[model samples]
Target: MTRITDTRDGPAEGARPGALPVAGLLLAAGGGRRLGGRPKALLGHLGRPLVEFAAGVLRDGGCVPRYVVLGARAADVRNRAELPGCVLVDNPGWADGMGSSLRAGLAALAATDAPAVLVTLVDQPRVGAAAVARLLAAHRAGAGLAAAAYGGERGHPVLFAREHWEGVALSAVGDRGARAYLRAHAGAVALVECGDVAAPDDVDTPEDLRLLD
Candidate 1:
């Protein structure tokens, strides 16, 4: 587990000083109604659980102290997806919607000293570490907010600069996630074209999982 620190002292030897300090927050609080009440993050993909795969991607991309937001079947999901270095946080308000989970994640990120946060969903099993690294690299290059776009459709694992933390923290609970906020602050956004549509392929139903298989 790599420790997150203030990089201002200058990167170690050959490391770059401007490398953005970013933490990853995985939103796994969904109840999985479409999947028969199962925790989507706990669902298996090949030989690994979904959430574990997502965590692996973030970790490999150099995102430290990853936080997982659990809700409905928190225990079962947490027990089944025992990812190392992940901090599990329960969202009692998950019933409210994705907005609640987003807020909960933001609150957790707020507690950390990281200068930025990359938010992603647990259901998107195919979003790999390289994709996350791309977003982080773009953010470090001066983008206030960096996002992955597939075929021109912007999607998850959005990286937010500490400057926009307050906006995300104060978001209301509803079906819409951070689209509105991102749209309102379009001037500061740095859209990275991943050229892969699978980045936004979330397993919302059993059929979706089947498609991945």
Candidate 2:
């Protein structure tokens, strides 16, 4: 792993000025099977691509060196979305499930100077920057593994300290996407309630498109 120089400005909470930056890993390679084979990353939200909004949330939350996994019409997403300053990773096996994208993101982060990673999904348009910030705050306060929760239920935008990246990558397979790892380490995960700040709505089938409205 190459020790990339940390150039992130305005270090986020828990990310000390001299310490490594926290990576924002966006898994946006879903093929949107239920949405008539449309790619979730290209779904429109707030007059822009869904990936744009999702990536913005991570950026605004203070995550540095954002990485977005692309699959299923990856070219279309790259051309249509204005994701400046974000590293795009291609996951050839994206159709296999979210786990592949998560693994790819982790692999990319492993080569960087990020100490932890905040993982978000492109289909989740409602989970915003506040929820991401809360998770980072939890990490800064000594929580090694933290996740955004809604009504006491674990949800997206999970934060994984560098120490757990390898484990998460290993467990990430198919669509489980860290479910096994998180479940095994449930006792250590800090569930930060974010229901008030954001909704865990997912834009999957046509019915789910209403969420973007």
Task: Write one digit per residue (lDDT tens) for candidate 1, span 142-178.
Answer: 8879888888778877999888888876754485778
- Mark the 10 consecutive residues where model 1 has the least summed lDDT: 1-10
lDDT of 2 by residue, 1-213 (tens): 111222234534335657776789999999989999999999888999999999899989989878889999987888899887788888888899999889888987887878899999999888999999999899989988999999999999899999999999999989999999999999999999999999998888999999994
Model 1 stretches astray by more than 4 angstroms: 1-20
lDDT of 1 at 92: 84
Candidate 1 lDDT (Cα, whole model)?
A: 0.76
Off by over 4 Å in 2: 1-17
Cα-based TM-score, every candidate:
0.87, 0.92
In order, the Cα lDDT scores of the candidates are 0.76, 0.87
